[model samples]
Target: MLKSLITAIRTLTLFSVPGRDTESFSNTLFWFPVVGLFLGLLQALFGYGAHLSGWNELAAALVVLGGVVLTRGMHLDGLADLCDGFWGGRTKESILRIMKDPNVGSFGAIALSMHLLLKWIAVLKLVELGAFTFIAAGVLLARLTQVVLASALPYARREGGTAQAFVTGAGWMHISVASLFTLLFLFPLLHQDLHALLALLAASIAAGGMTGLLSYKKIEGVTGDVLGAASELTEVFVWISGALYLLLSGNG
Candidate 1:
């Protein structure tokens, strides 16, 4: 269990150790939310500190930048690749080929910019509302969405790829475990406000589902890029939902 926890941390974060066994890294999918919890704590700390310092704009920017840096910008890369492939390609083959290319195109640049802008705006609003808790919850839900996608979708690559291991190794057990972690973290954070919690969950699941459906339609299954895109979209959707809730409640 300790090894699995370590493997989970190593897999999801920038942290690494020499001679670490990766044989069970896929099994660590059940612990993805655990990593999310750690990420959320960091985001909350950073945002809270900036809020205390009366730099809400800087806080929002830093929180978004912190997420990118902490995850090594892998999800952002996936979002860019997904946009470049989905819009730039005319067919499945072209889409897959385009996504594999290391270069970012016009579509990718636009998509990445729009996503970051929306995220920054949402974070800024949440900061104004003193709603740092939702940032952590958003992070947790983002990873939980990944677990859901891995368990539900088959791997897209016929020749196998980085995502194949997790798709093949993870199952309902993994999903259940990850969901348990999500509920454990999320419920306490939002138990005082059920409406906000439900809205965030609904938005997150919807975003993840739409992402998976699009991937299935395009590639007949999910890929590493799809998973990454799903995570980023889920995060954005959660933040948007929470932000909207704050606005409607006159808290923003």
Candidate 2:
């Protein structure tokens, strides 16, 4: 268990776990949980601390910005690419072509703006509801979405890169292990609310499934970028769902 965790950390973060090298694609599968947990914890700390500190919306936004910087905007870049692809082209092939290009298109710019705006609004809503746990879960599950993509799809690229290494070694077992840990962390926050728990789980499953299908139809297969985009977008969906639930249930 310790080894797996260390492997996961090495793959996900800047941390160099003993003998692990980031350049090797084989170690990518091991990092999913590590990254997910780390990012999740950070977001939790940020939200909880901000709320406790009586920080306003701007301060809360800074916490999220801190997270984005910590992750080096890796997922955001993918989100932009996905946005460009989905909106720029009429055909699937044309979309893929735009995604492959390093340049950001107009669609990408618009998408990035909307994503950032939505994330800020979502975070603000959670803060308003005092739902720190949901904010943390959103962060965790976003990264977990990446793990699911890594586990389920093949990398599009041939020569080994970050995506290749991860997709190559990831199996159902890795996803299961990551998911087990994710659920454990989430269980504490559910506070015995079986209905809310089930709702969140169903939402996550549906979001992931939809992303997977989209990846297959548009990209032919899932690449690292696709996986990253899936993580961020799924988190957005989960956040919206959680906010709505809290608002409607009078729990927020």
Candidate 3:
């Protein structure tokens, strides 16, 4: 269990876990959300502490930058690669080929720009509303969405890839367990505001589902980039939903 937790941390964050990774991806799956919980907590702390100490805009920017730094910007990079491939390629073969390229194209650059802008806008609104928990929830839901994506689709590459080990043998049990842990952790942070909590969950499901469906249609399966894209989209939707709720409730 400890090893699994370490593996999960090592996989999800830049944290230096002392031990080696667990060989089986499923063995490390149980702690995915736990790793997310740690990230969310740190993000919430960064946002909240900044909110208390600095300007709202500063807090928002700091939290946004902090999250990217924490995860090494892997999710955003994945989203960029997906944008370049999904929009630029003429066929599945071309799409995969485009995505594998190390260089970012026009599509990828625009996608990254839009993603960061939208994220900053949403985070600013949440910070102004004193909704730091929503920031944490957004990050947590992002990771949870990745678990579902891994379970729902086959690895797109026939030759396999870095994420193949995690996605190939995933099943419902993996989703259910990861989800259970995710929701349990969320309940405490989100329980007081049922509407926001429900909205967050619904938005996460919608985001992940749409991402998976798009991947299936475009490439017939998923890759690490698709999973990253899903994670990035899920977090964006989660934040948008929270902000929308606050607006509708006259809290924003």
Candidate 4:
């Protein structure tokens, strides 16, 4: 179990831990939310401290950077690939080919720009509201969405790939365990504000579900890029929705 946890950590982030990974990620998937919760806690703590110190704006950008640094920008690269391939390609073959390309096209550049801008704005608003604890919610749900996604879709790469082991081996048992890990951290967000948390969970479900639907239609299944895109989208959706909710409720 400890080695499996290390696999989850090493696979998900740039964090260096001493241990060999299990041959397969079926069990490693169980630790995904655990890694996410760890990332969320660090981000939330830094954001909270920055808020108290009156550097919330800089902290917001750094919070965004913290995620990228930890994950090594893999998810952002996936988002860019998804945008470039899905919009620029005329067929499935072309889509897959384009996604495999290392170059980011016009579509990808625009997507990265808009996505980063929106994420920064949403995060900035959240911190400005003094609700820094909720920062963990978005990060936690992002990783959980990936776990759900891996379980929901067949691996798209026919020749096998880095994510095939994780995606193909996933099941409900994995999701259930990951979900428990996710919720264990939520109680500290608002003490008794589960309604908002549940609503955010629903929002994440919708975001992840939409990614699955689009990936299914695009290439008839999922790739590593698809899973990464799902994580990126779900995190931003939760943050955007939470920011809006707080603003509308006069809590901001």
Q: Judged by lDDT, which candidate is best?
A: 3
Extract clashing residue pairs from model 2.
8-30, 8-31, 25-165
Per-residue lDDT tens digits for candidate 1, residues 48-129, read: 8888989999999888988998889999999999999999998888999999999999999999999999999988988888
Candidate 2 has a TM-score of: 0.86
The C-alpha TM-scores of every prediction are 0.96, 0.86, 0.97, 0.96
Ten residues in sequence with the least summed lDDT for candidate 2: 20-29
Q: lDDT by residue for model 3 over 133-198, one digit each (tens)?
A: 889999998988898889888999998888998886788988999999988888888757777779
| Total backbone collisions for each predicted model | 0, 3, 0, 0
Per-residue lDDT of model 2, residues 1-252, tens digit only: 455556666545555667534444444554565567577667767776777777758645865786687677777788888888877777766776777788988887888888888888887888878877777777777767777887788776544455676677777877887788778778877676777777777777777788788877776677767877887787778778888898989887
lDDT of 4 by residue, 70-100 (tens): 8999999999999999999988889988999
Clashes of 1: 0
Provide the lDDT at 188 for model 2.
Answer: 79
Rank the candidate models, highest lDDT first.
3, 1, 4, 2
Q: Give the TM-score of candidate 1.
A: 0.96
Q: 242, model 1: CA deviation in Å?
A: 0.5
Q: Would you list the C-alpha lDDT of every candidate in the order shown? A: 0.88, 0.73, 0.89, 0.86
- The all-Cα superposition gives candidate 3 an RMSD in Å to the true structure of 1.1
Poorest lDDT segment (10 consecutive residues) of candidate 4: 186-195
